[model samples]
Target: MTLKLSLSLSISLVLVVLFSIDTARAGYMEVTLLGTGTPKPSIDRFGPSTLIEANGRYFIFDSGRGVSIRLQQAGVALSKIENIFLTHLHSDHISGLSDLWLTSWIWQRQHPLQLTGPVGTLALSQHLELAHQADFSYRTKNTSLNSNFFPILAKEIVSEGIIYQHNGIKITAFLVNHYPVEPAYGYRIDSGEQSIVISGDTSFSENLIKHAKGADLLIHEVAAANSELLAGNPRLQKVISYHTTPKQAGKIFTATEPKAAVFNHVLLFGISERAVLEATRESFNGDVRMGHDLMKIGVGNELIFY
Candidate 1:
């Protein structure tokens, strides 16, 4: 009887452990850094794009260069991604928008792509549609794709508020300081008990700090250049002025205190990744990581990066 009781206790403990593991794997939001580069273009870092997968829905933020290729590499079908959120309308940020939109329609997307962004988004969409009219006409006439799926449904954000709420997931857009490119924005996504903040491209905006607080993960942009180089080049200085330095990003990370912070849309001019990390470390003593293309992070009971 004693041996049987001991065996039963062992089995119960094993089941509990298995149950805990399953629980940890379930309902966790997945974030994939599709392209972590800027406008200049690098084979290593394609462009600025992030993929969020939660509740069986796919949300893409910022369709930059090589977005379609990155999505293919990530094993996500173009048709499966229907919602896209744009932070701002910079050339580097929207360069891949037409490709993703057109390719998805060709690849059998049954509905129009739901696009959300700042005030100029609608105009951009209209122009893209006009530009692609010949392609859409040819495909619909020669192929099986429905012309109905060729349109892009765009929502232009005019203010800072909750922009999307569906199936227990809420996305909020807030203003960030990316001026002379006025009306720049950042985004906060919350689903279940997990949250993520994406700072599109900004230079230390207090509004971002307010929305990023207590998020599970914060993906922010950073620009790094040697001070000596900037001293001689006015153009470089102006470019750096529009973005957050590693040190400034560190301050924001410290203020928000997210569980983990990551740097994406990296703009490193004359410095190395080590230099950027060290500069950020000076202000933030939290878990901070440099983002790379195709890097996957799963946020749940604990943060998992693979």
Candidate 2:
């Protein structure tokens, strides 16, 4: 064999290796919506929930109705999901938590599920342990596995700080304005150079704007005034008093111009664009997108869709 031929072959091999490494690299991140409705359940909408996939792991934000099914539809296995972050303790945002806990427990992973939430998390965690006692006991006794079925590790946070981190991903939680609810939070996820922010459940709070500044993507709640305007009860009006008007959310977007903004908590501008229009009327000129149930919007270093 000629030395020149060997050198040429080595160069070819180096090129192949470099290409493979580049392909393997890339901050793979995917965001999938599980539920899009609020407490006022609608036939066309589910509750507030979202799934964040990054760096080969799944981190869920809130677990509303049909979340498990949605996750399955998104091709995410229950066993792969180990971390859950809750914005608040609202039933609409966390109603499906027990189901997630039970399903993961059924998989017998031999470890406590990671749950991060607000200050009252300890009490709620205790209640869940007690509430789901019969089911956990039944599974443990009836199954052949020898693992604790109801082991849940709770991490409660009462203030703003870094909540969770894995590999190169960082999830930082911050306080948001949602009065009467006492403590509410919004989370910013930093993976590599890309960042995404998820506003749990809050009114029109500029704190969210600040938290989500310069992020690649922002997913927050956009509430419509139609419900309050058309409802026949004062109770409905009270709900609006605490949540964001689409216009108010627009104003927030004005303050902070992110790469892209998505609204998903409630049925804000689904049927009527009145709320969205009101928000658009404000100062935000960027992309203010309306989020739907199970909708997937890719915004980051590289496009990821599943």
Candidate 3:
């Protein structure tokens, strides 16, 4: 073959390789655990939060404590955040909402913040607005801040169904039993090619198992069973009663049979990780991972964790 013809062919091959790489990187869902601990404060874990990136958009599930800090650590830009979903109105799960809203606004968030959750979400948004009235008023009056930037479009979920869908990303909310705190929910996000389920905070719910069925990833909450810490405190015991035990979570994992299962919002009070892992292993024959803040999963043909 002529040398010129050989050079042209080499260039064509290089272009093809580059295109293949780009295509492989696109159209996939990525999940990151922003926080993996419960309401109890811990130095290592923040609160219950996860970040989902798919279809060139970013969705956050539960803006728990330190969510903004974790998001910045994960190199997620405020501009890329399309919406925020709440599992429940539990203080631990929504504590970081204000931080995310106020801080992201300061950083020049030009679009309205989309907030979605159960029935009281609209009231919650109104409460937040009332809480920050002074700041919002002063900022807009003194600075060049556009009032539109502070606008929040809150969607109160009234029933179990598809709550949001856009750009090939669809999210569904279903009721979970975290009662006394009525109308709690679990969420399922389908990004066309792959799906993920987040068990916000619940006891054993058949509804959750139904939604999580055959998902690529399932991030569920787990509490230690009959811990010494719970024996004395009735309040703590009540909390534990409303949450799923590690073994129950394992059974849920088996029933759903996701490609991988992650235990998030872990409530470990005097219970070792070994105890929880062993309990889960009894029922779940598939991969089971304990979630930690900043942990990331890239969903492609296989689950890639970082």
Question: Which candidate ranks first by TM-score, i.e. highest?
Answer: 1
Per residue, candidate 3 scores C-alpha lDDT tens digits across 1-306 of 699999999999999999876666655788989999888888789988899988778899999999998999999987667699998999999999999988888777878899999889999999899999999999988887778978678999899999997777789999999988879999998875578999999999999998999999999999884556777888878878889998899899999999999999998777887889889999889999999899999987679998
> Candidate 2 — number of clashing residue pairs?
2
Report every candidate's CA lDDT: 0.93, 0.78, 0.88
TM-score of 1: 0.92
In model 1, what is the error at residue 110, expressed in angstroms?
A: 1.4
Output the lDDT of residue 117, model 3.
90
Please state the error at residue 200 of candidate 2 in Å: 1.2
Models 1 onward score TM values of: 0.92, 0.86, 0.90
Over 4 Å off, model 1: 1-27
Candidate 2: the clashing residue pairs are: 37-46, 247-279
On a 0 to 1 TM-score scale, where does candidate 3 land against the true structure?
0.90
Sorted on lDDT, best first, the list reads 1, 3, 2
